[model samples]
Target chain A: MANRVAVIGIGQTHHRSKREDVSIAGLVREAAQRALDDAGCTWADIDAVVVGKAPDMFEGIMMPEHYLAAALGAVGKPMFRVHTAGSVGGSTALVAAHLVAAGLHQRVLTVAFEKQSDSDAMWALSVPQPFSAPLLAGAGGYFAPIIRAYMRRSGAPNDVGMRVAVKDRLQALKNPYAHLHLPDISMKMVEESVLLWDPLHYLESCPSSDGAAAMVLGSEQAATVAESATGRRPAWVHGMAMRSEPTMFAGRDQVNPQAGRDCAKDVYAQAGITNPRAELDCAEVYVPFSWYEPMWLENLGFAAQGEGWKLTESGATALDGGDIPWNCSGGVLSSNPIGASGMLRFLEAALQVRGMAGEHQVEGARKALGHAYGGGAQFFAMWIVGSERPN
Target chain B: MSKIPATRQGHRPVAIVGFSQNHSVRSDSTSNEVEMLLPVIHDVFDRAGLTKDEIGFICSGSTDYLIGGPFSFVTALDAIGVWPPKSESHVEMDGAWALYEAFVRLQEGDLDTALVYGFGKSSLGDLDEIFNLQLDPYTMAPLHPDLVSLAALQARAVIDQGLGTEEDFARIAARSRRDAMNNPFAQIKRDDDVATLMSEPYLVSPLRRHCLPPISDGASAIILAAGEKAFDYAEHPAWITGIDHRIETHAFGARNLAVSTSTAKAGAIAGVGEGHVDVAELLTPFAHQELIVKAALGLADSVSINPSGGPLSANPLMSGGLNRLGEAAQAILDGRATRTVAHATGGPLLQQNLVCVLEGA
Candidate 1:
């Protein structure tokens, strides 16, 4: 059996379009330092460090973790780097947690970041390769058709994406670290925004920001000691999983990826959850674009097939009155550092379970789900956290 | 200060059941990464007498800069055709680290088998210019110091400290080339005398052209099985006894270039000195680096080092590290050795290192 692990510390930078105040190393250290403080530990307490990012092109550096090792206090310690596209953040944390769960380390610090301001992410992502057809322009161009397919298949209302865009921006007002705080966000504003890709308005897309997220995962013994000293309960890791499929195939379902569903099922099963909608109090899912909220709702099995948009229309995913609130921290639609976006989702879920999410806290949240996907929705990483330890 | 854990107690045992590699070449211009990996993946599965469906998980290691395109690993997945999807993850480091991740996942006791692979085509771009990106962006990278010059600095340190001489490097290079003659997959094989090697022009001061590893394009794959599954896959399994990795400060000025503290720490944690090592494979891309790593590992003089010519014969960037591990495991699997140690280095001038100890049951 695997050893028990828990999240004892969590920290993130105030995401923004550009964090010109600090260098890449400095930006990562700020979050790592905050996490160290939260866990009531020093640099000496960490057994290893795991770093993650989307792509090296975002910063014009190949494997930037090697350069930031000293800045992150990884000297004379095990330092590992992970890259799994956008889902890299969640996979990075999962790798760190496994160290503790495998009885290899007592405490591990995992971090993910993206300094998109250093270069044009869209251009970097759109770089043409040899012998491959340049059918897509950028991520938006590739995913736009998928959203259109979902609309045709589900027959959802045209205003659904606009509603999600407004709702998430409204929630960002409550999150101090959120990049975009649109106080006057409304459906009219989203509807009037430019259509960057057909069927997807500019307001419905995720913003490119420079940011990072970090968490300190500890074994059961370390968590107990931290709790006794700080009087703060740790968010127990009930279960975690990752799944991947080929980016392209003839019969692949781009709208509702099987990888996401299988990953959710595996994690939920390990958490002993039979009904995710009833068991999970809230969710922090990777909704890079507004439409992904409903798409993932069904993919995660929180709603029946083709009925996910109805759940959104029924106010079931809102933090104000929803039973199973999602994206209480504004989610990727509000701020996306690409690589760090998935980790923010995972971190927010832990925050909700620990009752540490001050303004965006879901009341009486005892269990929550965190979800992230990348690379044409072929890679999926998800985890379930709870206030109480698993049996 | 808390001491690092010396050993992982009661963890599940995992072994390298199968391994395969493509012949190292200056350039594989015709085939992309996926195309290069397809045959190697099939060969590894065949070597283990298993099918793709039997693998519980898959992991890979590669960098985008080699191909100058983002999500290179994503496209490489086409080789496996993951129809129902599989538990998987990836690392940006060398394939040895990917194998480490797979080893850890097996400790969860849910997965029985995993496939790990790494590939890189250094000829696709100017590695000298591209490698500078690994330095500190705010300071070292701005200087545009190439990899060869940085390695030369370490070589200079080794010589200045009297750890070794130019003749020692020449002998090691000559021995590697002589050994490569028996290995068909080696990129550079020549039976040259040490005196002849010493006459070659210096690629950089104190570092002759023979001292550097040949830039090659290659792919390698290894299949790992846990506990009883290891025996079912390979008749003589190379059981992984211990594996550990550590990183040093990125600032060269802050470190002792003549010694590899990170390698020593990892070797100690991996229990390299626990038993007699019959053979060892060190990923010393630069000839003098072998001296530092061999000393750090504390291997006896009787231990055969780089019997397959090591990276001096062929260095394929991300894949080279895993190749060392695979070579060490092959020694045990082929009944040529009972126990072995493998070492892999990453970053500039051995800033990070990984050590794995394997033994036949």
Candidate 2:
């Protein structure tokens, strides 16, 4: 039988447009050191380290993990790098969790980061390839058509996205680590922002920040010891799932990606969640654009098709009074470091389940979901965590 | 103090039941990355007597930098014809690490079978200029030191430390390429002697062109089955008795360049010393690295190393490590050896190393 696993520590660097003060290694060390401290253990306690990131082009460093091993105290230790596009951070954590769940290691450290200031992601992403039409658009250009398709299909009001942009920025006021703390954020402000992509305003898009997120995953035995040592509860992992599909094919639904749906189903089955909106007290989902909030709501089975926009417009996802609050730590919309975005969501979910999400905490949030998607909506990873161990 | 856990005992037995690879070439213009992968994917699935749906999990290894595009692995999934969506994951590292992930995933016992594949087209771009980006951005990358120059530095260290001379590198190159004559998939095959290779011009100080691997386009796939399924997939399955990987600091200047401490540690954990190795496949990008890696693994002269020519004949960047593991497993299935050790390396100067011990049942 697989061993039970728990997240004993969580740490993240303050999201910012540029981390000019630290080298890439220093940037990651900031989070890893904090994670080690929170775990009440040293690097010696970690049996392995797994690092994840988006395209190396984002930082102009191919396999930066090689240079970072020394700083992460991974020398003479097993180190693995995961890259599944934007979802890499979540997958990286899942890989680390597997080590503990398989009884192969007692404690595992996982970190994901993106140093976007090192290089221009737009140019790197626009590079022409052989035999394929060039996609000169940055990520926004590619997703704009999809957003337009969603608007046409759902008949959602244009203000729905503006509402999300305003709500998330308000949530960021409570998160000290969030990159964009717009104290004066409002729906009118979002409407006044320039349209970076069709149907998506500048305020709706995620910021390109430089940041890192780290977590210490421990086996059940190690978690018990850590809980006693730290005088805090560990977030027990209830389920983990990953799914993938071809980027382009006939009948492929990019709006409601099958991969994301299957991934959610797999994780929910493991967590024994029959109704996601009711069972999952809150969620931290990958929503780089404000419109993705409703899109993912339907894909995650939180709301029925075409009705997901109703949940967003009704103020049900707001951190202050929403029943199933989403992205209470401001989410990717407010602060995104590309590669670290997925991990930040996963970390935020763990924080909520453990009641460590201080100002952004959902009252009595006992169960939470962390979700991520990447590669043209083709790859998905998700996990469910709770305050109590699963039966 | 080395903190490697003592190799665990009495684990679920997993075996490499099927393996396939494409013909290595200087540049395969006829086939794109997906085209190169389809045949090998089908071959492995057919050899395992399974279909796409039967495989419980799939994993792949590749990097976007190789092809100068993002999400290369995303399109490659089309080769598998994923209609219902599949349980899968990917790594930025070499396919050997992909195998490692699958190995760990299979250990969870939720899945019984997995398919792993890796591919790279080194001919896509100027690798020498492209590889410079792999260095430490704040330190080494700014220097614009290409990969050959870096390997030359390691070669200089080997000679300076009296580990080996230029003649030894020539001998390794000669032996490896000559062995390639027997490998139909090898990109570079010649029976040239060490004396002939010694007369060649130096690509870098103390290293000749022959010492480096060819810029090849290739892909490899493997099918892994755990427990009783291993028996159902293959007649003589190459059971993975032990496997482990370790990495060292990237500051190559701070460490002994002539030694691979990471490989040595991984070899010990993989139990490479426990049994007699009849054959070994080492992923050595440079000819001189063969000596450094052999020493690290504690392989004896009697061991038949690189019987299939190895990376010196054809080195496909992301898939090279997994190919080494596949070649060793193939030898076991072919009745060439009862026990074999396979080693794979990544990063500069063999900074990262993985070792696996396979035994025939």
Candidate 3:
């Protein structure tokens, strides 16, 4: 096996409902270029480009990496595309890093994007099959029943969800690239927001935005080279893990998915993390809905079983002063471009460890966790990035 | 090559320990993707003398556009009974790419085995129209040119370039179809005269019906084991000595229609520079593309090509490419050849290409 790889560069675009100015190819390029620039390299400096996007229905284009390959300067190099639903972004990055960790490519460019404006996500996701439950109401609807189950089981205060929404929106104010930046976001605004999925209000749900996220992953040798070239330390990859379970299976525990827990456990073990709640400085987790923040907190072992709501109830997850400042660069709830959302969180965590998160930088952060789950929480991907090089 | 720029990490050399495929057909549309993969999945595990519980990772590739639904991969999981959960992933591309990802992931040392599968049913919609979705929507889909016409454009360009004649293209179809006679999974076969093919009417102007790959409906699965573990599974493993893939521009105008840059680059990167190849399976849905790929990969004229008749005989859209890889590996497993190369191509005008070099061990 090869030595550990590091995340040397990261960049993301301002996610919005529609980036009308740029084409889909350009949208991805924007992030890729920024990542390369941050790494102090050009397209020629990269080895391969691994990308991921949601269903082609969103863009009405098939396997778009082929067309965009030249645009990304992947003409003479290996190029790949991955799709695992919402987790695609995280999975794409993980796959790219594996190439580096496995001693394949030195400087890999992995990007994930979605131009949701080109087509309706709801329609694309709701294309009814012969005998499947119609996703007529979009992703939030399918997840709401599970959310209700968590509410009933945990008996957490209703305020927990509202608090998470307010916190993430406030965090978005600090992130210039985040969508849904409410200058004066409050709990009332969230309460007054129209209800889409019952028990999940509009403000509580994630926004469907067009955006892209990119990262340049490197092996140990490339890491040293990048550090010397950019005058910046690399965020070493400590651990990564992914898991999936079939949807609609009998006794499929959607409320507290086993795959999610198992993935976190595996990553934590690999990272030598005995106590995620205290060992890690912060995390950037996929929480499209507010309640998911605490839910995932517990799932990731950041909090004890059924007691994650307490962490949210306390001011323990905020950037001002918290044991674990989650989503300091805003998260999936604040800005989402489906395919790229997970990678954005991942890249943000790397940024924090690299001390390049600008206004949302977590002070003295050394280790951070980036997490994302998709396919009705049946798919999970997470990585640990640290300030120090990992063996 | 020590200073070779833009290279990714190397994964543990993985081997094809076991494989199972459905009887290729033309009208498997009625059977859902999950249903088609059910027996095949079990058969692959049985062939490997293992169980799903032993497989470390499960990755699949297929296009949602083929099924006209988003998250097609999610629904297809029922076939494998992924209920207890497993390390899994899916790619929107062909299963060939999925194998690449799994091959790389196997480098983690934690996973000694991986399962990769792909399936597609092209009978639900008119294949020509459905394929348009593979093109850029705003610029290409709106124009709605079918694959046959697009391929004809390439075919015409290749002919104009004086690379191959229309007769040469017909011979490829004739030869592959005739060879496909013994392939139980092939969708079409014929030993008709090359002159007869030349006399046939054009499906698209300048391209005869025989030149096109028959629309196919099928699913395929292959088992991969890494390092020493591969020996425990198969007595003679088809070891993937080298594998690489690259992409070309999507805009037909930007890419050279007569040549496949991606294939050539991937071939060189995949160590086609190494020892001689005994057999080669080229994923050329169109007849002329076989010659194009053969030239790009620099395969020796003495090498046997697509002994399973190639994609010109049966094309399953998303899964076709991986089938090519499996076909070549089967040759190695059967001791028919000591070394072979398999190539898979995707996207319009052959925008994406993957090359896998398999060696018997």
- Please name the candidate that would achieve the greatest lDDT relative to the true structure: 1
Check candidate 1 and list the clashing pairs: none
Q: What are the lDDT scores of the predictions, listed in order?
A: 0.92, 0.91, 0.86
Worst 10 residues of 1 chain B by lDDT: B1-10
Tens-place lDDT per residue, model 3, B129-239, is: 777777776688889897788999999988988889989989999989999998988878778899999999888867899888888888899999987788788877888
The full ranking of all candidates by lDDT, starting with the best, is 1, 2, 3
Which candidate achieves the best DockQ against the true structure?
1
Interface RMSD of each: 0.7, 1.0, 1.5
User: What stretches of model 3 exceed 4 Å from their correct place?
Assistant: B1-11
lDDT of 1 at B106: 91
**Which runs in model 2 stand beyond 4 Å of their true positions?**
B1-9
Task: Give candidate 1's error at residue A334 in angstroms.
Answer: 0.7
lDDT for B48 in candidate 2 is 82
Clashing pairs in 2: none
- How much of the true A–B contact set does each candidate keep? 0.88, 0.84, 0.80
Error of 2 at B321 (Å): 0.8
Docking level of model 1: high
